[model samples]
Target: MIEFIITALEALALIAMAALVFNSHRNRFLNRYFALFLVFLALWVLCGFPQALVQEPSDYFITLVFRLAHCMAVLATGIFFLFGLGFYLGRAPGRTWRGSVLLATAIMAFCSLSDLIVRSVSYDQGRFYITNGTAFPLFPAFMILCGGGGLLCIALKRRESIGPDRARATYILLGFGIFLGLAILLVIVLPGIMGSDITSDYTFFLVIIPTGFTAYAILKHHLLDVRLAIRRSFAYLLTLIIFGAPIFLSYMIFRFAFESHPNLETAISIIALALAVALSPSALRWSNRIAARLFFSGLYDEVGLLHEVSSIFTSTANIREGLAAATAIICDALGLKQLQVAIPEEATRGKGNWVIGCVRREKDILGFQEVEVSASPLFLLHDPMLLDDDANAGVVEDVRNAAMLLEMRSRGIIACLPVRGPGGNVGILMVGRKVKRRALDPMDVDLLHRFCERAGLFIENYLLSSYLLSMFEELSETRKRLEESDRFKTDIINVTSHELRTPLTILNGYAFMLQDHYERFAEDERRQYLTYITASCERLNAILDQFLTVSRFQAGAIRAALKPTDLLELLAEVKAGFIPEQGRRIESDAIPLGVRVLTDRSYLLLMLKNLIENAIRFSPSEMPIIIKAEEKEREVMLSIHDFGEGIAQEELQDIFQPFTRLEEIDKHQVGTGLGLYIVRLIADLLSVTVDVESEPQEGTVFRLTLPHA
Candidate 1:
């Protein structure tokens, strides 16, 4: 009954440890090593059995099975060494180290096959005779080399390491070291001291100390979960296997320990009884709480972290601010050193500079251009790959891609997480290495990917919204311009109505007198009245002509018929219309008579007429208005210079806008502000380019250039 209880308890404990290992993510190096360690340890336990149960003869299958189990035990020792190395390094053993380990295992296998490790088995007087093989000594020596050497390596490295890595290494070595020391004593040292007359049935049970400690590390400190996913059924199967194997194995070791030493057996039983009685129910409960807390701590923290991030996402509205906040919060939660978010300009289809939208814990902005990402060979890389800084051969082979760009922007970062849009990758999320100095695990990458996807969508929507806002603003400005144009038109009609009404009323009164009372006035009076009517008629004609010109331009009804025309003659004819005042004169001597240009004659004359009129209006009463023709290689230039209170240099362009007038101009000047504006319009219609040069209080010149015929 006691043996059955021992077997059941040992199996249950091992099975629980196996379940802990199996339930974690398998991609983690530590979890993978831990899982393999448990498998081999169980295989070694299965080979131990009572002397009567196994046949010693070469013909018996039981003898072969027992021998095979012995070989498996030696191999398990080598694998445990591997696990120890991986635990400290956070990766698989390098190629050279792995090769050496494999070589050692093969040599031990050859020794076992040749009956050197386990020579033979026999039935001696109803008891088993397990003969010592010649190479059996190699087993004890190999065990010391692997197990003892692994502990020393851990101790040396732990002293050199710092932070959480140091703490982890320390715990692993202490737990594993104690377990190995006890096993060696029971299997080898104790037998030598007691003259090979004692065996330990409890050697297998000692493994629970190391196994349970590792399980606690996984749950409390988040060790194996970096990239882990373990199933439930696989863990349960391990329990069943461990339960049956230990019972058979313990009975065989029991016979060896008690063969010739009754006192040794009694001492083992008393030690076991003492341990059970000394621990009260309350102490057992305290141990249970510690175990349960270790297992559930990581799960609780993960849930809380996830919840906090979700809350942050829900509250965020603005793209830039939200990304900034999200990255900051995530970094804080995960203990990341840095984070950056980048997006390309959608307006120029990624031709423009990329928008470096957000960063957390970065000292400066990463000015990555949009073309760097767009034209890169790895632009379409879908998944996140490990990025190494100072990479000469592998990841940095292409410097133009997103990964290299990210690395160059900042140091100590791990991976470039792509935020994929419908039109492929539209943005980037660069995550820095964890503050713990470990590379981002697979699970960390996966979580970041999920968040980045949602963040990408938010960024896309925000960009679209911003684009629409700009378009609406432009439309609003255009509407304002149209409304102003309508107001100006109304003002023009009112001014025309008032100016024409005075002239029309005077003409009406004069005509009425001339038709009714023909003999009342003398010859001189009749001549003077006719002259007055003619002046009024001319004033009306000027107003009507300007209105017609503006209407034609607005309706797009004016088409200039370009033909060869003398530029000098056109300016001369327009200048002739401006009558000389007492102080002002229209000078045309600088222009030659036959300067030919490809222009519409009527439009050229109209442009010159407006320029000449404007020159007369702005010039001082005594100043000379110069009409000059200058020749360039491809065009003929007609310039009108005014030496009046010349336009301010800043207002030169504004003077060509309809109804725009200089503030310093005389209020009594009898002219509309539309002359220069009309000249620009006519020049445009005739395929002519007009330019203005002016200085404040000096002079103003309007140069109209027409292509040479």
Candidate 2:
């Protein structure tokens, strides 16, 4: 009767778990593997029932059905591992995972079919047992590979997993770890080492526990996206209820048979039932552990977890992101409660290394506190030789160098691992005490060391790559500037040659006439010719002065001598330079007495002169060039406005560019375009700002606003 109950429950669990994955969202890779696993589990359970019945003289052809069922159960082992790989990776199984499944299933098939693993079932002590054969050892070896491999894959990705993913992985490691431990003891250790028979009754527990957890994960969805993958867990759970419901009816039938007869056989069974009821409290706890489906809550796969942490170096763009990821891995793998990471000063290229800040996990509450610290020689900790100091006597200087040291120690920081970059150590990876508050073991340190080595090199390379990219961009920009400069030089030479040739020709003609035909020529003609030569000389002198100004500024020979002077007086003088017609079109107010400024006197004058000249050239003959002055707080404004053809908005910015003459401006205009460019150079030299506002068909205004010296 007890065997019947166990068999019925196992059958229900297997069928429910199968329908849960296969019925809905079966297209999911993990679900497909899980569904396949359920099929084998159901087959094993059905076969076990017949094998157990061998005690009843005829266990439904146990020789054939029992042997195939053992093979099929081993086949489920491979499928379960594949499911885990897909579930934990949260992706489809790759070629490697698929190949492993095929290889394992093939080996199980050969051994089971050839009777090399389990030759026959034996009925003894009113129980059926599957006795091992010569090749039985090979079965456990296959189990180790599939089970260990799946777990390793989970660990490898744990660092990147978060929220539901992390929780799911944690459950898998814990639950499956218990399963593995039990399988080794029941199938390998007890049989191979103790040379005992394998009981058919206890074998179902291994499959039942993991199946329960998988069903739960599917129901919840987030841990493994139940909505996307396992939409039918509740349906399966209902099915379990439907199938296992007969167990209570059978119990009632047994109660009637035992109570009505009251024989010696029935009396022992009743006493056992009474003891079970009495010890229900302890049984409830064990049942809960079994129902919860994992012996440990947060067990970690050490090697895989370290791989997950090392991957952060290649995966994240910055130290902050990498450290955040590393923190999660550390907490999960090493069971650290709180973690603190500090970046070195040299990485930021500063006085001291900075604290990348702190992350504290109190219970499940995880948060970051950004507290920056400076100047600690903690980079020396990168050697991997340093161990935790009980009293911290050796690290007194480090504490002195960094004030946050005492606070960190108080918080139970166990080890300071240096995160090294190309330039020595980039930061400090400070870990706090373990979650269990135990000192770190050798394995923990070694894992950290390996992770840090990979992380540091990868981070250094990222920084190096970023730096190289920036330098390349800067070099490209510098090349562009040089090209523009070359173009400007070419334009200057063309304009200068044309301007110079015309003046030199005039001077040469005038000199020849005055020297050879002085007596023959009229006095007035000679005087007019002499005047032309004098004008030509002055024009040449002006051009030469412009050239000299350009050369002086370009070579950084000019310096500003700032002193208090009347800006209004200077503007009045400049306004006088541009004479007006009878109507006084060039208008101005009375010069203020104390509108003083501190600027290079000559540079300021040059700026004012250029604005007046530009205005005169662009404005029409009928319109006057206006020089307007206004007083402002802490500064004075001098405006040069032209009432003629207004400058276009698009070309306003370029007016200050050297030798930049607009096509709209009169081609017959007599001056070189260097006036405004010279003004720009002078303003920059003297620490003055020059701005312009203009519109086509309206007038242009050049405003010179300077601060008081």
What are the lDDT scores of the predictions, listed in order? 0.64, 0.66
- Alpha-carbon TM-score of each model against the true structure: 0.44, 0.53
Q: CA shift at 312, candidate 2, in angstroms? A: 5.9
Tell me the deviation in Å of residue 250 in model 1: 45
Please give, for residues 126-169, the per-residue lDDT of candidate 1 as tens digits. 33445667778888888889877677767765765554445666
Per-residue lDDT of 421-494 in model 2, one digit per residue for the tens?
55666566777777677666434664666666666676667667767777899999989878767876886687
Residue pairs in clash, model 1: 25-228, 25-229, 48-249, 49-252, 50-252, 56-121, 116-135, 198-257, 199-257, 583-622
Model 2, residue 683: distance off in Å is 2.8
Q: What lDDT is reached at residue 296 by model 1?
A: 36
lDDT of 2: 0.66
Q: What lDDT score goes with residue 44 in model 2?
A: 75
Reference-based TM-score, model 1? 0.44
